[model samples]
Target: MPDLGKYADAVLSSYAVSLVLLVALIALSIARSRRVARELHEVEERVKHG
Candidate 1:
C-alpha cells in the first residue's frame, strides 16, 4: 500500500465522496431504466390490444 500518513484524512474523505457519488449515479440510472422499461411495456400492450 502507498503511504498516506501525512494526508490520511484528506485521502479518506476524497475516496468517500467519490464512492458516494458513484453509488448515487448507479442508483439513479437503474431507477430511470426501470421507469423507461415500464413505459415501453405499457405502450406495447396498448398497441397490441388496440
Candidate 2:
C-alpha cells in the first residue's frame, strides 16, 4: 500500500469511512439479492398451484 502516514489524520479518516461504506453496501446488496430470490421462488410456487 502507499504511504498513508504521510497524509493528515483527516485523510486517514476519510479512507476509513469510505472503506466502511463500501463494505456495508456490498453486504446489503448481497442480502437484498437473497431476499429477492426467496420471494421470487414463493411467487412462482403460488402461480403453479393457483
Candidate 3:
C-alpha cells in the first residue's frame, strides 16, 4: 500500500466503516428475502386448501 502519510488513520477507518455497513445491508436483505418467501409459500398453501 502506498504511504498515506498523516491521513492514513482517517482513510483506513472510513474504508472499514463502509465495508461493515455494506455487509450489514446485504445480510439484512437476504434475511428479509427468506422471510418473505416463507410467508408467501404459507399463504399459497392456505389458499389452495381453502
Best by TM-score: 3
Worst 10 residues of 3 by lDDT: 41-50
C-alpha lDDT (0 to 100) for residue 50 of candidate 3: 85
* CA lDDT of every candidate: 0.97, 0.93, 0.99
Off by over 4 Å in 1: none
Model 2, 1-50: lDDT tens per residue? Answer: 56667676879899899999999999999999999999999999999998
TM-score, cand. 2: 0.82
Report lDDT (Cα) of residue 22, candidate 1.
Answer: 100
Minimal lDDT window, size 10, model 2: 1-10
Evaluated at residue 19, the lDDT of candidate 3 is 100
For model 3, residues 6-43, the per-residue Cα lDDT tens digits are: 99999999999999999999999999999999999999
Estimate TM-scores for all models.
0.87, 0.82, 0.95
Candidate 2 lDDT: 0.93
Candidate 1 lDDT trough over 10 residues, lowest sum = 1-10
Q: Which ranges in model 2 have alpha carbons more than 4 Å from their true place? A: 1-7
Candidate 2 residue pairs in clash (backbone atoms < 3 Å): none
Query: Which lDDT tens digits does candidate 1 get at residues 1-50?
Result: 68899899899999999999999999999999999999999999999999
Q: Whose lDDT is greatest here?
A: 3
